[model samples]
Target: MKKNIFLVLMGILSVVSHVCAQSLPQETSQSIGIIEFVLKNSKYEDTKCDIHSCQMKSKDGGVSLTLTHATMKQDKEEDLHYLLKINVQGTLFSTKVEVRYRNDPSKQTMKTGKRSDEVDSSYKTEHRVLRSWIQFIKDSTTSKS
Candidate 1:
């Protein structure tokens, strides 16, 4: 039936994606930290920065990201963002992770009658470009050393 064929195609696609992901692409760093990723990959529009978040407009379709939060921590060399420190196995690894941002609070995209917490992660949009940068650095460094 049609359902059987669809399932087979899904299975093959999943396998292909998995195999492709094993060898992650490498990312080059500008200043050895998340500062570069944040500044470069974020919207090219003027960013109105605040204590905890920065407002930016995505160049793709001019979508605005308000109160944006990111996954990467600011490196000591940079004064633009915060640094995320993690203790793993009693050792510390300062990682350059990508960021996630909450949509403009004024705009509601979820279903009605559901509270923000009840829906899911408030940070809805993923900065794919920035994320790729983080992944590239992590893979290149960790895999070698």
Candidate 2:
């Protein structure tokens, strides 16, 4: 029957999609205390903090971060604000980090001029800034022996 055939195809598609799904990759480091130390000594303005997590924002308020997890996924509306998640899990001797921007920041461009279509660069985009912040933390954490 047509209904039976459709059901079978749908089931197969679901199985394939599930099998292909994967969690975002995390960056690991051998130093455990470095993450906390770097965070405490960070140059950025500390908006909030607690035992396991912290929220930081730039002085200009152009970029904000709440330490947390995953990968970036774009939304239907690009103009709306989005939450960028960066997760850090630490153990006695090591740490792991994963960043996720709910609304893909890479797709969001910056306007250069008064014209709507006029765009400058992605350097100032949310994604770039997030990546920079992650790299800074990693560099600062790992570089210290």
User: Using TM-score as the measure, which candidate wins?
Assistant: 2
What TM-score does each of the candidates earn? 0.22, 0.24
Which digits, one per residue and each the tens of the lDDT, describe model 1 over residues 1-145? 9999999999999999886654222222222233443334544444455554444444542233334333344222222232221111112222322232223222221111221111122222222333333344334334433
| Model 1 accuracy (lDDT, Cα) | 0.35
Model 1 pairs whose backbones collide = 70-99, 71-99, 74-82
Best by lDDT: 2
Q: Model 2: C-alpha RMSD to truth?
A: 15.2
Candidate 2, residues 1-145, lDDT tens digits: the string is 9999999999999988875542111221112124435444435553564443446654444344564332222344434233334333333332233343333345422221221121122323333444455555444334542
The whole-model C-alpha lDDT of candidate 2 against the native structure comes to 0.40
User: For model 2, which pairs clash?
Assistant: 68-86, 68-87, 69-87
List the candidate 1 regions with Cα displacement exceeding 4 Å: 1-43, 58-61, 70-145
Worst 10 residues of 1 by lDDT: 110-119
